[model samples]
Target: MGQIERLADLVVRAGVNVQPGQGVVVDSDTAHLEIARAVVEAAYRAGAGWVEVIFTDGPIQRSAVDHATVEELSASRPWALARIAEWRAAGVASIGLVGDPDPHLFDGADPARVAARRHDEVRARRDAMFAGMRWSLVAAPNPGWAKQIFGEPDVDRLWAAVSTAMRLDSADPVAEWQARTATLAARAKQLDALELTAVHYLGEGTDLAVGLPPNARWTGGGLIDHDGIPYLPNLPTEEVFTSPDRRRADGTIRVTRPMVIAGQLITGLRVTFKGGRITEVWADEGGDVIRAQIDADEGARFLGEVSLVDRDSRIAKAGIVFHNTLYDENAGCHVAWGQSFPWSVEGGLAMTPEQRVDLGLNQSGVHTDVVIGGDGITVTGTGPRGTVDIIRDDEWVL
Candidate 1:
């Protein structure tokens, strides 16, 4: 097999753990057809009963999302999510490839229509595969993405970076990851034992207080369900994270790095949180969208996640910002302000939104991850006794 084919096989058989005879779903944009084809072949090699490819075209989505009618937004597709759920329930495997070349393709689009269509899709799959789903989110570096990250389209370099980050260069990446997971799990257990009060974040243009829920649990590495079925979420993950209390955070958080928000790249984005809700949002570019989002709805202003990254993060070390989630999110400590992942906690999806909210789970159809770390960043945790440093200079200080 060629390099891409081998990578796809590793992702399907090792990362997602495709079971024999189980159906497989490959989701990607048309720009990623090369990787998608490799995925199909890998799925078949893994003994998948059936393999389905869903190619999403960003330009087409941009047109509809930016110019579609209100009715069009209201009648947005629902069957797609339903089909995914059906496959999940049947123990099918799913591998998603996400990396946008133009992050801001929908920057000036109608936010209401976006939210409307978004809610419909979220509502559809709200209960899909609460358990028994083998899925992994991976990346396929395209020319567009390469151009975004490297100033010019250099796919070879991008692929090299991705492969290195994913440890595909290793002689036995699976075994390497096994050791890494144990280390991360041990760290999570240590942090969880502390029962932290709040995490203090500090950096240039940043000072934020991140509060933890009473039952907040630190999570790292691959996820294993109650049934002991392990699955990776992000193929090149190196962060430990937890869901945060959406109603108790306070202070200012400036986006230390550029991010692709709602399809447009937002730079110099900054926000002030009061009483756990974003009270002010500012950006050098794409500020209007941030304002629109903060004004979108009540839940939009609160936080959903707080993740920590080490200095060893591949994206950060590479010194290239891709402005894509599949890579950027792996670079540093970041947070999401909407739509908490049910998989973030034990029994996350089994509970309804209302039930989840009662347990302090932030629920929304939207999940926006924004980086908040920089060279001078320092993250300290406080508990009943005192404070302890967690990260400094974008490196883990603990």
Candidate 2:
């Protein structure tokens, strides 16, 4: 098989681990038809009972934001909500393709309006997966994504970069991923032993303290689905993470990597948190876009996740900015605002909304990751053992 075909097999066997006779869903953009089709075929080969393909159109999505009335944009689509219930009931496995083909599709649109509509759409899918459905999100190489990264539509070069980050060039990529994930998992256990109450990040223009829940447990490598099937939620995964104590994040943090939200690029972003709430949000570009998102709900201002990546991480050492959060966030230490993962804190998966709120677990429907650590950024943990170095200058020392 060719490299792309090999990637398809990995997405099935490793990404989500499609089981025999399982129903699979392939959610993709029209621009990623080639890889999507390959994935569909791979699922069938893996003995998937059926494969359902859903295609999203970027231009159509942009047009809706451009002309739709505020009231219409604000209303949740019943059809979308109904589909989530169906997927959850059927126990379907979903593989959503990432990698925006047209990063500037919503460039001229109103940032607030764009964020609102995108949040509404994402809520349905996120709800489905969080509810019970098994899912994975992987990226595909296309001309538009290639052009955005290399400025020349050189898809081959972009693939090479992605492959290097994914360790796809290995003779047995699946085995390589398995080995890497195991190593990372061992690191997570060591971190959990620290019994950290919080982590402090210090760097130029960055001094932020992110609190962890009382029983927070670090998890990474992969996650267990509702039915006990394990899957890596994000392809090319590298970071081990835990949900934050949403009520305790404070200080200022300067984002080191560029991020895109609702098709807009955010760079040189700096945010300040006071009383666990975002008091300031600024960026050299796309500041309005991020601000609009942070204002989506009360929980959006607080942090949900904090992740650590060492300098030796494949994605970090690749020395190329994929501009895709799936890849960029794995390049260094990062934090996510909104929607705490239930798995991060003990007994969280069984907690109700009120209980979650009381425990300081963020309940926002949004989960936006922002990379904040790179060169000069040092992360130290405050735990039962007192303060200990976790990451020093992008190196995972613990």
Candidate 3:
């Protein structure tokens, strides 16, 4: 089978693990219809009860972001929200196929307005679905994205890189992923046994500390939903992650890879935290956009998650900066702002939002990750037993 078809099969059968008689939802941009169609076909072949495709248009979205009134921009279509709710209520599986066809679509737009206009209601609905449904995010390469990365529209090259990152090249991709997930699960168990009180990051331009709650637990790879269906949230995931105590982070850290945020490429991004709230931000480019996003809401300034990945990650080994968080964040250690996952701590989902905030779990409409691991980076975990090296020279030590 061709790579696209193979990827469709992987996403349907392994990524979201669409079971027989289950409904499936595929969300994609118009530019990605090829892969979206493949996913629909694969889902049906797997005996899916139904498959729905929601196609988005990038240029139209850009126009809306640039010209729409604040109220209009913030408003979400009731039907869209209702559709997701219905799917979630029915225990459906979802696949999000994302690849920005125009990475710089809003480069000259007003960053503050763009930040102010985020669809809060839509985000809440999506978060609710995330907490209950089986879902996966997969990439769909397009000429525009390829041109942004390589200075030329080489879709074939982009496809090859994406396929490799997704492990589509493996003789048995499903089995390979299963083995990889088992290994990551073992690593997560080791970190959990440490009972770490805090993690300290040391490297050039980075000397930061992130505290962990007593109930924090590390997890990676596949996750089992309420119905016992296992799913991979990201096609090329590598990091084992946990929510940090949002009230306890401090010090400064530098981003090692460029981040494409809201159609702007942010480079040389540096941030300082005091009492878990972002106090300062600097970047060689797109600092205004970063500031605007951090100021979006009350909890947007706090740390929501801290994830660790070593140099040996598949994405890191590939040595390509995809400029997509779903891929780049997996290449190294990364930290997120806003919206912590409830599954990161024991009984987290059951806790009320206020109760979770009391435990230092951050809450907000934004969840953005910035990669921060590379050569010379060292991560140490501190607990009752003293400090233990968790990562050294960009490699996982224990």
* CA RMSD, predictions in order: 2.3, 1.4, 1.4
TM-score, structure 3 vs. true = 0.97
Q: What's the number of clashes in each of the models?
A: 3, 0, 0
Better of 1 and 3 by TM-score: 3
Give the per-residue Cα lDDT of candidate 2 at 79: 85
The better-scoring model by lDDT among 1 and 3 is 3
Give the poorly placed runs of model 1, Cα more than 4 Å off. 74-78, 107-116, 294-297, 343-352
Write out the backbone clash pairs for model 1: 103-263, 104-263, 104-264
Error of 1 at 103 (Å): 3.5
- Across residues 1-398, which tens digit of lDDT does each residue of candidate 2 receive? 87788889888998889999999989999999999999999999999999999998999888889898656777887787787778778888999899989888889798878887545657677767777677888889888888878888999999898888877889988899899889889988998898999999898888999888888899978888877887888888899999888989899999888877878888899999998899998889999998888888778888989998878789888888888999999998899999888778788778876887788889786789988878888999999999999899888888
lDDT for model 1: 0.76
Error of 1 at 60 (Å): 1.4
All candidates: TM-score: 0.92, 0.97, 0.97
**Which residue segments of model 3 deviate by more than 4 Å?**
116-118
- Give the lDDT of residue 279 in candidate 1: 86
Off by over 4 Å in 2: 118-121
In order of lDDT, best first, we have 3, 2, 1
